[model samples]
Every structure is written in C-alpha cells, then in structure tokens.
Target: MAFSLGPRAASAGYRLAVFDRIGSTNAEALARARAGETGPIWLVAAEQTAGHGRRQRSWISPRGNLACSVLEVIDTSPAVAATLSFAAGLALEAALRTVSLEARMRSPGSENVTFHLKWPNDVLAGGGKLAGVLLEAETVAPDRLAVVVGTGANVAAAPEGMPYPAASLRDIGIDIGAEDLFGALTDAWAEFRIVWDKGRGFGEIRRLWLERAAGVGQHVSIRSDSSTISGLFDTIDKDGCLIVVTSDGRRVAVSAGDVYFGAAASVGAT
Candidate 1:
C-alpha cells in the first residue's frame, strides 16, 4: 500500500516510501542512511512483521496501525539529535488532535478524553498509552548526523496483553485511517520541525511539552534497572531530565527510566 503527503512535505523536499509490509521502518531507514541516503525522507509500513520499540521491546503492528520512520540530517551532537523525539511526539499529538477536535467539534466537552503527551515520547489517552516513539542516530560525517524518528501509533487497534493499558483512535471513537494519520503527521511534523529549528528552539518545545504533559503534578514512580523512585512528577528540566520531588522533599533529576503515573503500575514509555 502507498501513502500520500500534502503540500508541506512536498514543499520541504521530503521524500516518502510506503510499503505493505516491512520488518521495521527504522531499520530500513538506517540501512538507507548507511548507504549514504541521508535524507529528510519518511518510510511507512502498512504492516510490520518484526517491529520493535524503545529498549528493543516488540512493537506488534497489526494491519491498521500507523508505523513509520522519519530520516533527517542533523548538524548537531548526538545528544542534541536525540531530542528530535520530543518534536516527533509533539507532531504526533497535533495530528491526533486534528482528528479528535474534528470528531468532537459539536460536543467540545469531550476534549477531556483527548490524548496527551507524556514526557519524552508517549501519547496518552484515557489514562492509557496511544502511541510510542524510538530514536536512533548515526554520525555520517565529521559534523553531520542522520537521525531516524520511528513512531508506532494505535490507529485502528491497540495491542492486547500489553504490559501497560493501551488505547487506539478507533477504540476511543476517533475514526481515522493510517494513511490519513500519516498525512496529518507530515503536516504536523513540518510545523514542529520549524519550531524545533534543529534543537536551537528546544526551549519552546520544552514549554509546549510541559503544557501538554500528563500527570505533572501527580504522584509517580520511575523504575531503574535495580531500583525505583517515587515522587511528585514536578517537571522536565531544560535538558529534558525529569524533575521529581521525593517525599523527603529532595528534588531529583532523573535522566532515563520508565515512568508510571498514579497507582496504575502501568509503564508508558517514550
């Protein structure tokens, strides 16, 4: 199956490759980049056989999910390049909002059920996960980098037996097709990309992310490989470290860990 893009992607000179099935869009984009195809190109798969998510978790792709990877050049350090995942999250949220507001325009009160942005790169809806992102970076030249933003969104169906609660657009009564979401994503990405300005404008991105942050003032816990920290999810710092205030009143800045909000015991990741 082929996917289509609107004027924004076209105007940005972005290319697209859509497939009916693939092992993983991120893997494909990485292979192309290795062969010197450092592009602002997007690869989408209608279905995936061996999809994966952050920390190498399997991302099961049914026929109706939106699975895609975006490859772009970056003139920054690997640390900074990784922040594009935040931009991807914002773009995905915007795309979802377009469909959501349209669905509940007449009865706007239902916007409360709309999706939210979890720190890093998770989209939450109905207090469950709606989408995820995985980022990988490769240094192509001495000062040039290629980063792939891989995203898997629950469009038609959310996976069952997931470690965390999951919800899909259709599950929430937001009727949308994978192709349509991709188009909306492209437009949203273009706008967020401009706002990001290659990491220079991340302060704005950080603020916007905070504005949509889920459970910021709520009780939360983050699990490390060997331990867990429980605290109030105060905010995310300037460099994206999660700022949490422990019960002892000590502020801790957690850089990497799986965060859980409330007593859900469910792990929603970026």
Candidate 2:
C-alpha cells in the first residue's frame, strides 16, 4: 500500500512526508530536519527495513503498524531534551484513550492489569511489552535543538520471534482505525509541545508521568554494562533519569539501563 499523509497534519497546519518504505523514520526525520525542514513535520512509512531502539536493539516494523517520527525544534539543554520521551509517552497514552482503549500513565501498583512505564520510555501492558518511545535530538544552533520523537506501537499484531513479550492494541480489544489513531497522536503531541515551549521544564510533565508510572516504589532491577543493581523505584529526576533507592538506602541515579521489574520472582535473574 502506498503511504499517504492523512488529514491530521493538514488540520494541524503542519507538513508531512510519507513513504511506502524507509530504512528508518527517525533517521529520515533527522536528516530532513538538518536540511531545514521547518516546524511540525512528520516522517512516516509503511515499513522500516532497519528500525532501531535504544541501545541499538532492532525494532520490528511490520507493514500494518504505526511507524512514524515527529520533528520539532526546541530550545533546551540536553538534560531537558531527555524528558521528551516521557512527555511523548503521556501524549501517546492520551491518544490511546481517545480511541477508547483505557490507556493511562503506567506505574507500579496501577491495578490496571500490570501496566507501567519501563523506566525512561517504555509502556508495559498486562506484564508484557506494549509500546516504546525514542527521542533523538541534535543541536541545530546555539541553545536550539531539533528533537525527533520516534514511536512504534503495535496496533494490529506484535512480533513473533522476539526475546521479550509484546502486545498489540487488538490484543486488548481496541479496533481503532489507523488514520484516527495517528490523528489523535498528533493532536495530543501538539498540545504537549506547547507545554514544553512554555518553559515549564519537566516538573509538570514529570508529575503527570509519575501518576501513570508503571512501578513506582517497587523492587526492581536495572542493568548497565557489567553491573546490575536492585532497588525500590524512587522517583524521576528533572532530567528524566530513573532514581532507584537500593536496599542499603543509597539512591542511585540511573541515566541508562535495562530495567526489569519482578524479574527475580517471575523470571530468573538477569
């Protein structure tokens, strides 16, 4: 099927570029932004041959899924830029709710069937992987950065030969149209972009994120390099780092790591 930019971008007064297939939407958006693509451009594709996740993990991109990148210019430090992923997660949750999916910010003890945020940018559903967000920023000018927020949501089906468990919207009985879903996402993102532009930083965004956090104050394990630490989920720093209070009461700030909750009890230790 040929990819087409739907009415969402036009209604939002933004330009969009759609492709039938691409190596990666995020990479394409970054290139375009560097080449002077202005505000609010979307790069979407039906298939991504070389999609990637954080830490260079391969992302599966089937044809009938949501694979898109949103490019926006923001003036902020790298610290604040890191928080965009959390903000995007909130927007995505709101977008899912618009389609009657009962999506909310995931945190520990949510009582919503094991949904929670897997640290910086993953949304968990029913104790499995649901969706993930990736934020890539580059300095376009002094104090100015163009942020490309890439997201992949399993709308129809999840991957089969993956290491981790994955879920799709259809698995939860959500039968939303793809066009409607993308439109809702763009609307939510536009509204959140305004919040970021107003110099609110990540305070308000962080609070909303924590409300929907997947495993706040739960025993969790985070792995980085050759070391792993188990701790209670503490809080998120202003820069969007995961703060974990270890068993010894020392709060360790994890900027990057693979987080596993219930890993010790459910699955064997990592």
Candidate 3:
C-alpha cells in the first residue's frame, strides 16, 4: 500500500509528500517551511538515515518503519507549540491500536497488547517503547511560527541495545506494513489536531492525554542538563510543564527532562 492522507485529512485540505527513503522527514519538513511553505502537509518516508529525537538523540528508522512529519505554520508561542507533542502522541497511539486490532482479527494471537502514552513524547506498548514523537519549531517571521511534528513507529524492526527497551509491532504479533500505519496516523492526527485546535483546546487534549498517560502517580526521576529531580509524577500543568512533587513537599515544574520510573528513578536522581 502507498502512503496517503485519510479522508478527514484530505477533506481538511492536508497534503502528502511520500519518500521511498529519506535522510529525515522532520528535516525535510522544516526545510520546506523555511522555504516559505505554509502548510498542513505530511512528509513521510519509508526509511530514515538521519532521524533524531529531542536533544539530537539518534532515532533508528530503517525501511518498513514509519518515519513521518507534519508541518504547520501557526501563530502560537513556542511554549504553546510544544503541547502539540501530546496530540502527536495521542494520534500515534490511536493509529497503533487501530492497525493492531485489524492485524489481530486476521490472525488471533496476543489480544493483550496495550498502548500507553509516556510523558513528554513517547508511546509505550506492553510497557516497552513502541513509538516516539519529536516536535521542532522555528520562528519564520515576526508573527508566523513554523512547527514540524515528527512521529516514528517501529513497524517491522526495532533497534537493539537501546538505553530503554523497544518493541516493534511484528514482535508483538501485529503484522502490518508502514503504509497501513501511516494512513491511520494521518486520520488520527486529523482527529486529535482538531482537539488541539492550534493549542486553543489544550485543556481537552490534556485531559485526554492524562487518561492514557503512563507513570502518572508513580515515583519518577527527571534528569535535565543541569540537575536531576526525583519525585512523584503529579500531572502536567496548564502550560504542559511536568509537575513533580518532591520528597520535601516541594512542587517543581520541569520544562524538559529525561524521565525514569520506579526502580530506574534512583540511577541518576537526586
């Protein structure tokens, strides 16, 4: 199957750019935006040679994996733009469930496959990392902000020896191609992006996100560039800052951090 936009996405005037292989869909989307492309366009690749996550961390996306990015030029502040990552997570999770269920019906296997949203920007399936979302933004003009939300899912392959555990759909008995997942993703994104409403409907998005969120109310450690904070994972605030309730009863809002949970919290935590 080829990559195409869903009915809702197409009707909403979204465009698609499919690449058999590419250095990075996110990079290409950002480059197009910089070149005066004001769009709600999807850039998808069958493989990624130079894909990256937050902090420039390498993200593996060989052929048969889904490497897609969506570009939007909005008038929201950068901080508001960051909340769109939650919508991205919701979209990917929804798409995974939709495709996985179709796979299960064809060949019944493990019917216990579950998906959860990890704080900040990841989707967890059966407690292992299944997909990730990366948000990049640039101020193209005084009032125009260009944002690209990139999503990658391990459809047929998963990298080995990663710091955190990773899982692919095939590993968990879901045998589907990247194109099938991409089609679902565009549809899911359309639904959730409306809920996000260019950051205006973030309150509803936050509620929906917290509903499927993993590690909430659990002990977690957050590590940033300067220091590490260990505490209970309270909730994301109005502006999407992670609210961590410390051991000393202090509530600290973390804007960016690498999160660890349960036994892993003490590895590099304060």
Candidate 4:
C-alpha cells in the first residue's frame, strides 16, 4: 500500500509525494531538485534499499520504517546550510514528543536509554541508535539553491549486526503510527522554514538543540581522516562545528568527524 498524509497533518501549502518503496528518499529528492523541482516538496518511502547516512555509511532501512526527505529552495549562505541539520534535529525531537514517547535528550553513557546529537546530524538513542539526519545542498540557479533534508527514524525495528548500538521506537514501548510520525515531521519542518526565512537567527533552534545535546561536558573522542582528538564535549558553534576542550586545555573545533562516546571514544580516536 502507498503512504499518504492527511491535510490536517502537514501544511496545506506544501506538496507531498509518497512511494511504497525507493532506493533512497534523499537521492530521489536530490535528483528532482537538481532537475528544477521547486520549493516545499516532500518525498517519502515505506522502505529504502540504499539509504544513506553521514560519511557514506549505509543507513539500515527496513520495511515499515520512516524514510523521507524534504526539498526546499532558499537563498542562504553555506554557513546557514550547515546549521540545517541542527534545526532538523530540533524538529525531529518535537515530532517524537508529539507521539508521547517521553523521549528525553540524552548522551551516550552506561544508562538504559539516552538520545544525543552527534555533531552535524545523527540522533543516538539509548545504548543503541535511533535516528539520523542528512543535509545536502546545491546551487541550481544564480542566488538560488536547493537544500535536501533527509531523515530516517527506526519506527519498527533496527538493522541487525549494526556497526554501533541502535534502537527503535518500539524498543522504548512507544507505538507511534508511521504515518502520524511523518505528519508531525512535516509540520515541524514547515515551522522551521518560517524561522529560517525570517532571518531570526539560530538562537531559538540552537537553544532547543543544546537542551537535548548528547555528551555535553563529557569526555569524547572525535576521529577524522588525518588525526584524532579527545576532550570534554563543549558546545556546538554557530557554524555547526562540535567544540571540544582537549585535555591540554585547548578548545578544538571539529568541523567534520565521527564522534564516539564511552569506550568507543577511545577506539574512534585510534
């Protein structure tokens, strides 16, 4: 069966395209946007075969999961583009709250269940993973750009033998209908767009994000291609960089790196 959203859920101004299955919502939305697709387009799929995550990791997407992407055309700097993930994280958190999951913001630790934001865009839940966000942008016309925001939430079950710990909404005893979750996400996106257009700055979004931030003030290890650094998790910069205070008392800003907490932090640094 095809997935369709009701009018009361999403903004009436936007157009939604639903699919029974797809290779990746982000890829489809990117192709359409590059082909001159206009603003406020939502691409959704019931299952994804080749879903993507940050740093080219395979996002484990199964049937009955939520895989969707929204394409928006806006004129903004790359810095603003970078912050889109954080904004989306806030929006996703709000969507989850609507389902009454009692999903509080948490960092990776020895606790039972915790969700945290890993730098640019990954939502970690409990001892396992929950959801993630991906943002890709391209300039199609002069002063005009296309931004594709892709999101995947483990509504039913997580992939088997995952690289890291992962979780699903069902694991937490929250049974949110997939369609209802999609509606909430779209509505949240619409609200975020309004804030983005008004140039109100990222203060509000950032504040909400930090409130749910993972590993803030905890020791973390960030690994990139060339090197590794470990330090206390500080704050996310306006440009979306993960700020870490190293043991040497130097605050190093990590622009792009895989953040790992707990014992994985030591392993990631190497």
The top-ranked prediction according to lDDT is 3
Candidate 3, 151-234: lDDT as tens digits: 989999888998888989988878999999998999999999999998999999999999999889999999999799999999
Show where candidate 4 strays beyond 4 Å: 1-9, 101-115, 198-200
Model 1 spans with C-alpha error above 4 angstroms: 104-112, 265-270
- RMSD (CA, Å), candidate 3 to true, equals 1.2
lDDT of 1 by residue, 1-270 (tens): 358875798798889998989999999999999899978999998998888887789997889999999999788998778778888889999988886776677556554466788876799996579999889988888989889999999999999998788999888777768888888898899899999888999999998988888888998888778778788999988678899899899999988778888765334322
* lDDT at 40, model 3: 93
Clashing residue pairs, backbone N/CA/C < 3 A, model 1: none
Q: Tell me each candidate's TM-score.
A: 0.93, 0.87, 0.97, 0.89
For residues 20-39, write the lDDT of model 2, one tens digit per residue. 88999999988887898756
Poorly placed runs, candidate 3 (over 4 Å): 268-270
Top candidate by TM-score: 3
Candidate 4: residue 48 Cα off by (Å):
0.9
- Deviation in Å, model 1, residue 250 alpha carbon: 1.8
Q: How accurate is candidate 1 locally (lDDT)?
A: 0.85
Clashing residue pairs in all predictions, respectively, total: 0, 11, 0, 5
Q: Candidate 4 on 36-137: residue-level lDDT in tens? A: 897678899888899888878898578778999988887776667767777888778777776544323232231234456666677766566778899888
Global lDDT of each candidate: 0.85, 0.75, 0.91, 0.77
